[model samples]
Target: MSTADDTQKTKDPEYLSTLERGLRVLNAFDADHPELPLSEVATITGLSPAVARRCLHTLLELGYVGKNGRRFILKPKVLEFGSAYLHSMNLEQVATPYLQKLRDQTGDSSSLAVLSGDEILYLVHVSTERKIRLGASVGTRFPVHATSLGRALMAYQPDSVIDAYLDTVELRKFTEHTITAKAELEKRLRKIRQQGHDSAQDELDYGIVSVAVPIFDTNRQVVASVNCSTSTTRVSREKLIEERLPLLQDAAIEIELALKKWPFLANSLRG
Candidate 1:
C-alpha cells in the first residue's frame, strides 16, 4: 500500500512510483555498464538501496534481469522492449531492403537510424562483404553533433528544437574534425538542410567517412536518416560525395515512399 505522501510526491495520482523506479533501474544499465552490483544500481538510478533491491528482484522474477552472484545484468528478455518498439514502428522492416540495396550499390556499410535523445540510434545496418571498422551496429548510439546521420536528422527539425539542442548540449570533440562550437554546428545543420544531405569525414572515428540523407513521411516531415559509411583509406571524400551520397539519398527516398504506403509508418514518424 502506498501512502498519500508517496502518491503526492509523484505529483500524479495515476503515476506508479514503483514502476517508474523499476524502469529507471533497468535504464541504469547500458553498453558501458552492462552489469552492476545492487549498490551501484541504487546509486546510478538515484534510488535507495532497499528500493533498488526490490525493483531488481521484481525484474528478476519477470525474467528481464539476471543475477550473477552479487552482480545483476540485463537478461535477453530485456530485448523484448526494444524489439516491440521496432516491430510496432516497422522501421527496421521497411528500411532493411533499401539499406541492403544501398550496401550492394556502394559496397560499404549502410544504416538507418533515428534521433533518440541527443544521440543517433541505429535501427538497421547492412554491412558489405569487405571488412570495414565503422563501429556501428543495430542499437548503437552516437552523439548527434558528430555524425552525418545526426546532422541529416537535425537539419529537418524545427528551428526551436534545433536551437534548444545546440544551446544546452555540451559538444564534446571526438576528433579534430568534430564540431565543438554550437554556432558552427548550427551553420553546418543549415547547410545540410539546404543541400538535402550531410557528410562526416573523420569526425566520429579516424579513417571513417559517412554521408546521410533524411527520410521524410507522407507529410514531408523528417522521419529518419539513411547513411553509407566507408573507410577513408579506401575511399576519398570527393569520391564518397560524388558516388555514395546519391545512393544514400536514393535509399532515403525509397524508404520515404515505402513509409507513405504504410499508414502506421507514416503515423510513427517523429515530427
Candidate 2:
C-alpha cells in the first residue's frame, strides 16, 4: 500500500484515548457486576488500580457513578448517556409508525431496540390489548443471551466483534431455553442470521415468545432491531415459525427503507 493508503487507514487522533478509556470503565459495570471495588474495576477494564480510581472519581464528580464504601456503583444520572443516544437517533420517532402498524396487523406487542454493550436497550414499544402481554418497557435492558432483539444484533456482528463481546460478557441463563454456552449461543445466532430472524421462546421470561429481525441503515449495516412479542400460551411455536417470522421480516424491510430516508440518520445509514 502507498503512503496515502496507509494514511487513510490511520484512525482519527482527536477521538481522544482518555475519553474512550473512561467510557470503557463505565461499561465494565452491569446487572451482575453492578458494584465493584477499585481493584475489580481495574481488572474488568484492564486499567491500573490508580487509573481506575481516578476515572471512577471523575465519573462520581460528573454524577455518572457513585461510591458506596469500597465499591463503586452506577447512578441513575448515568441514564443521560443512553438518553443522549436515544435522542440523537430519533429511533422512537422513526420506528413508531412501523411498530404501530405491526401491532395492528399481528395484534401483538412490538418493540424497537438497540445494542448497548452486552444488553439490548428498548427505545420504542407498542402494546396490544391482550389480557396477558409480554411486559417490556422502553429503556428496559435485557441480556443478549435471553432476548430476541439482542440475538438478532449479536448474530449480525462481525466474528471478531462477537468474539470480543462474548469473551467479556457472562452468559447467564434466564430460563430453560436460554443458551448459555458460548459455542451453543454462536451456533444459534448463526442459524438466526441464516434464517433472517430470531425466534426466542421463553428464554428471557417464562411464557413469553418473540420474533425479531435487524433494522438496517441505507448501507445495509444493522443499526437497530425490531421484535414482535406475545405470550407463549397464546401462540404456538409452529405458528411463530410459519407466520410471525414473515411479518417480522417484512417490517424489517420497511424499517430499513425508512431508516435510509431519515434526514438525521442519512449519514450513518450503511450501504
Candidate 3:
C-alpha cells in the first residue's frame, strides 16, 4: 500500500476530519493543477461533492481561496502559512544573504532546501539574472535521489533511516543520467558523505549541473542543504566541483554559525 493508503488506515479518532479535508482541498492545487473545478477538488481529496463544497466555501470566506467563474484557485493569503513558518524559523533571513553572496560569487543560482519526505523542498533561492536550465524558485520540490541538494542532505542521515528510505521509495528516472539503481545510488550517497559535498550533472534535467553541501545546526546535526546550480553548457562538472562547491560549502558553514548563535531559532526549527 502507498503512504496515503497507510495514513488512511491509521486514522486517529481525535483527528479532525473536517480540517483535514479542508487542507487536502487546498493541497490539491499545485503547479500542475493550479486551478481546479469543484468536482476535481472533490476527486483529488477523495471527499464527496457536498464536503468539498463546504471546505471550498469555508476557505473562500476565510480568504484562503478564490473562485474564478466555476473553478477555484488558491489566493495569496494562503502564503501566510508558508511565510509564518519561514519567519518563525528565520530561514529566509539567515540564509538569503549567504545564498545571494554565493550566487554573486559563482554567477549561478544558489538555493537552500530541507528534506521533506522523499523530496527536497526549496526554502530559499537566489538566481542569477541570466537564464538557466534548472530554474528553482522558493517552494519548488525535487526528487531526493536526482539532485545534489537531496544527496547532500541524505548523505548525513542515519544508516537505518537511509536504508528505510531506499527500501520504501521508488526511484523515478527523470533523465538518462538519473540514478535509478538503489545500490548505485547508495554508493553515490556514501561517496557524498565521505567528500562532504555532492555534485550532479544532467540528473534532474539536461544541461544542468549542481553542487551541494549539508548545513549543520548547533548540535552538529545536518539541518539542511545548500546548493549552487548552473547550466552545464556554461560550466563543466569539474569546474563546478573545483570552484562553486567551495563557495557552497563556505555558505553552509556561515549558515550553520548563524543557527548556533540564534538558539531560539534553532529550537523553533527543531519544533
- Give the number of the best model, judged by TM-score: 1
lDDT of each residue in 1-271, candidate 2, tens digit only: 2355436545665556578679989989976999999999999988889888899999999999998999999999988876787688777667888788889988889998878889888878899877553477777788888898999988998889798887888988777778889888889888988888888888877888788888877656677888988887788767875777787788888777777667566444221
If candidate 1 were superposed on the true structure by all CA atoms, what would the RMSD be? 3.7
lDDT of 3 by residue, 1-271 (tens): 2487548745876677678789989999998999999999999888899999999999999999999999999999999998888878787668899999888888999888888889999988998887866688889999999999999999898899799899998999999999999999999999988899999999998988889999887777777889988888888999889987777878988888888777777665433
Q: Tell me the alpha-carbon RMSD of every candidate.
A: 3.7, 5.6, 2.4
Clashing pairs in 3: none
Candidate 1 structure quality by residue, lDDT tens digits, 1-271: 5667766878987888788899999999998899999999999988999999999999999999999999999999988988897788776668899899888887889988888879988888888766655577889999999999999999899899898798779899988999999899999999998899998898987889888899888777787888888898889888998988777777777888788667786666573
TM-score of 3: 0.90
Model 1 Cα displacement at 60 (Å)? 0.8
Residue 230's C-alpha lDDT in candidate 2?
86
**lDDT comparison, 1 vs 2, better candidate:** 1
- The candidates, ranked best first by lDDT, are 3, 1, 2
Candidate 2: minimum summed lDDT over ten consecutive residues — where? 262-271
Angstrom error at residue 264, model 1: 1.7
Q: Which 10 successive residues of model 1 have the least lDDT summed? A: 262-271
lDDT of 3: 0.88
lDDT of each: 0.87, 0.81, 0.88
Each prediction's TM-score versus the true structure: 0.91, 0.72, 0.90
**Which clashing pairs does model 2 show?**
218-270, 219-270, 219-271, 220-270
Q: Which portions of model 3 show Cα errors greater than 4 Å?
A: 1-14, 267-271
